[model samples]
Target: MTAEKRIPLHILREITNGFSEHSRIGRGGYGDVYKGVYSGREIAVKLLHVDTVLGHDDRQYINEVGNLLKVKHPNIVQLLGYCYEIQNELIEHNGANRFTRHVYRVLCFEYLQGGSLDKHLREESFAPDWSTRYKIIKGICEGLNFLHSCEPPIFHLDLKPANILLDSSMAPRLADFGLSRLFGGSHTHVTNRVVGTEAYMPPEFIKDAYISHKNDVFSLGLVMIEIIKGSSGYSGYIETDEVGQFTQKVLGNWKNRIKATSEYPLEESHQVQICIDTAMRCVEPDRNNRPNIAEVLDILSKTETHIPKRQMADVFPCPTIGLKSESNMLEIMVAELNNNEHIHCNLMPTDNSNRTVQQLADRETSSDVEQVIIGRTKEKQKILSILSESITEEMVNLPIYGIGGIGKTTLAQLVFNDPKFQDYTRVWVYVSQEFNLNKIGNSIVTQLTDKISNIPTK
Candidate 1:
């Protein structure tokens, strides 16, 4: 462990603005954390509650500083410095001369702007994308692996979303090691007292006070499941079947958003299923059956990873009832196309086999757009006839060439929504001023998998 600096208490007070409530960021068992600016660098200063910390013989403070100094990894939070000092004040008690002493213990850590993972997990309107969430899970695994594979394995008794902080770029960094215990060449330890969150505790740890690396595996498993499902806590209250069945059911519940965002049926993806399999193995009832940190990392790092093809249609899926009008769809389509090369909309079909309309909100209706179109019957019939002619031949390129604001998109939408074309496979490609055949082909493949796009609005 490197030599940590000893910071003065007066400097900590000055930077934290006298530990004002405005500067406070979080509160834990130790004390309140304040955001401080030291030497032009933002830092998190945890001013330990002297009364509370002193009771435990300053064990929590000592453990945190010790662990932080010992471990240094990209995924683990770094310790900047610490302050352990004392202040003496002369006083008169009972009309006699006396002196009082105040001890100060403060730990400084790198400040993360994005706050904790728990904040993002609880957001209903906008959750992290699958790619970001996957990176976080992977990072957590790497951090745990590093700790468990040390010269003397360290057991982080408290590993949860609240303790995981996100940096400015949304990369996760594991923090809060007050509950961590280092084992000396021993794989497991037995203690009468359990000190960790109940939801993340393994059965053996809670029942037998047994502590090992497997305990961390169990916690990691729960965290992975919650992160994927966007649940705030474990779903232990829910009656669960076998691990496979439980995973299938969870994925089935999120199949709609998964399809629209991922552009691939997650249930059918081998890479996704492997994650489920690994999570199940980690959360096994028997610790002996569970995979260790190395095995878990190996399973998660499989090279047979599937990368979804970017599609225009998937980027801007079918126009939704949530949109205010045809103009709204046009605005969103244009904005998404110009702003981003890839987009994930919540409005899409539920599953691969079901193309029926799935409403985005409680007020959304399937016939919302149908009512907005006043007269397109003749236009629809003309497009249908042209499509019929092209279907009969081996291959044909039939384009409805027209000038701007000529109702080309409206005519196409009407024909596509017609009941006759419901059974036939359809692909919607919206080429702008610059046309790219490769992108269009990918869009077609995505549409074949039941992801449909809309006509471009010029």
Candidate 2:
């Protein structure tokens, strides 16, 4: 669609009217996914639950669509068209009725009948044979390879089974491009605000560490392990202390088996073992050590020659006792602090040299109560420059936290715009109210690394 031409609201109304219950295929954080017959062809329509031009979510929604439209690839899901409409409807709850305006932002996509990989694995009756699993894994690797091989590698920040869709013949396709990012220059890394599923996320990303294509590889490794085990492999590790240890142990065992023989038993197929090994390599603690998408594809191709059965090996368990204790301790401290409401102290120190600390604290408090007042534009720019310089010297995760209107985002924007930031090839992303973790992750991946956006099916 051209920028000058807009989809009429009447046409959008007609489309929604045609979306019967029978056409509803799935539902997600965005809204409902419907399989619609338009112009005699089937298409998957993702109807957004919110408006793209209203509230704080508008910027994020519009940005996502604009980014998706710019990147075109065979593996990436194509955005055929979009529909926007608003309708006033009455809702009754507990015998009370109210009128509200509902806004819809619907996106149309190519239909894939095989469904999501997550749905298949979660269902007991839909177990895929070892050969089918291998093929799916290979397809994903090829898609990723294509993305990485782009002029500037793309990073798929979120790599998970649920995002992968299958066509009628079980061919895997990458479906979502909402979170993909395109790497534009020589600087290899960019620090992003923490996003994505915690279980599948790399430790660095979780800590707001410098992110790169390696983060995507780490996530892909987690997905690969889950596919091999025929389970949501990392779910059990959630809230556990020994999650890293467990992952290392399982991956090590698989790698040892793969290294020992070429003609392994069907029950212990070398392909499965190698796949696990590659995944482990991707999840290496050091991002520098993880393989690139092209290397991952090569490895997967080499291992795809054989099929392996599922083995009931001893599963490694994450240590949760220590973690639970820490959580309980934090909760107790918070409760105690909250209960002592009467206790107050003058944070300002008696020493004259320490007055700046008190002044800064007072300013912060005032900023929270009202918007930060910048009397001089030049002074504001100067402060931003100083902060950015300080941040650049350290390779650590430092959050730019402050009150909403106290210029946290404004300061970040200045840093992003600085000429120095260009050296690192920065990607400036804003995760406003409409943030979707999966889409954010995908954007980072496609933009930063060489990975195709094609999500394979169930």
Worst 10 residues of 1 by lDDT: 309-318
Stretches of model 2 off by over 4 angstroms after superposition: 1-9, 18-23, 51-63, 70-74, 84-104, 125-128, 186-194, 236-268, 304-458
Candidate 2 residue 119 C-alpha distance from true site, Å: 1.0
RMSD of 1: 16.0
Instruction: Name the 10 consecutive residues with the lowest summed lDDT in model 2.
Output: 354-363
What are the TM-scores, per candidate, against the unseen true structure? 0.60, 0.52
Quickly count the clashes in candidate 2: 41
| Candidate 1 lDDT by residue in tens digits, 1-458 | 24437678899999999999999998876578899998899999988776522445366557667776778998888888888777776778899987777668888889988899988889885353555666778889999999998767878878889889998767788887767877775678898765888888888988898999899998888888878777686645233456657778766655655677664455324455666677777778789999998888887676223342121111111222342453454455445444434333222322233354332221233334455554444545666676664564133444555545444555556665666665554445666678654445435434443344454543
lDDT per model vs. reference = 0.68, 0.58
> By lDDT, who's the top model here?
1
lDDT of 2 by residue, 210-273 (tens): 5677877887887887776666645522323554565566545555544464234443465665
lDDT score, candidate 1: 0.68
